[model samples]
Target: MHKEQRDGRQEQLSDILGKLFTSRGWGRKNDRLRIESAWAEAAGPELLKDTQVLVIKRGVMEVAVRNAVLMSELAQFHKRKLLTKLRAAMPGVTLTDLKFRAAAW
Candidate 1:
């Protein structure tokens, strides 16, 4: 293979990775823009500093929250908003639910 061919293939691979950076659902890289947008909107700046979203399996967001109180608060206060924002961000992202669990920090 020529250098140009190698470079072209590598560029293709990069594009694939860019797509995957959006979502790795079902162990397959698909529609990553949706996931990235969803994740970005789901958490507010204040909350995100303390929590981490580990994964989105199917339509559930596996979130690692720092404290039980905050988790409960978010459940009551932010769950709906987060899900709504997620939808706005991803459009078709599978994260219809947000599951907040105490994280091991």
Candidate 2:
């Protein structure tokens, strides 16, 4: 295939994938990945292992902690600071609160 033909086909495929993702609401999945990355940065490695960013809904982020003691400490002591870091890290996303819970898994 010619270079020009390959380029045209690549662009067409890109458009098709974009439309498919949009139609299936895959953008939210992308946003979730970004949020998880931001959470890792904001929470740091030591805490990252003990916590997981479950989901975000209506500006509230639900996080799963490894244990109830850690959850309590995070909810009482670190919640505000974590929220501040998260909001700063992802300015485009609305992160108003952090809810901590013991991990179901």
Candidate 3:
């Protein structure tokens, strides 16, 4: 009811939320989502349709392409450019490299 009590409760709630987020690895999952969104933006809708981010572990992003030709093109030509764009888009996150593979879906 009092202002002091309300402030204390707010702080407690904030602390609890922080702990929950950390305990559940929400931060990493959020960063991964950001990276995926950035990749979609950088790759464009067409390219994005044929490619999907498989995982990001230890600063490396593994991407799955629909076909070998697309994978080769992405790895040989677009990898560096995509990385640069991703870094620019997500400065808070570090993406060291991208690995592309031909995947069924």
TM per prediction: 0.63, 0.77, 0.78
Candidate 3 lDDT over 1-93, as tens digits, reads 212354464345666777789999997798778878988988999899999988878899899999999999999999999999888988877
Ranking by lDDT: 2, 3, 1
Looking at model 3, which ten-residue stretch has the lowest summed lDDT? 1-10
* Candidate achieving the largest TM-score: 3
TM-score of 1: 0.63
RMSD per model, one decimal:
6.8, 5.4, 4.2
Candidate 1 on 38-99: residue-level lDDT in tens? 56656867887778777778788777889999999989998899888877777555656888
Please give, for residues 16-50, the per-residue lDDT of candidate 2 as tens digits: 77788999989878887899999999999999989
Which candidate achieves the best lDDT against the true structure? 2
Measured with C-alpha atoms, the lDDT of residue 29 in candidate 2 is 86
Off by over 4 Å in 1: 1-37
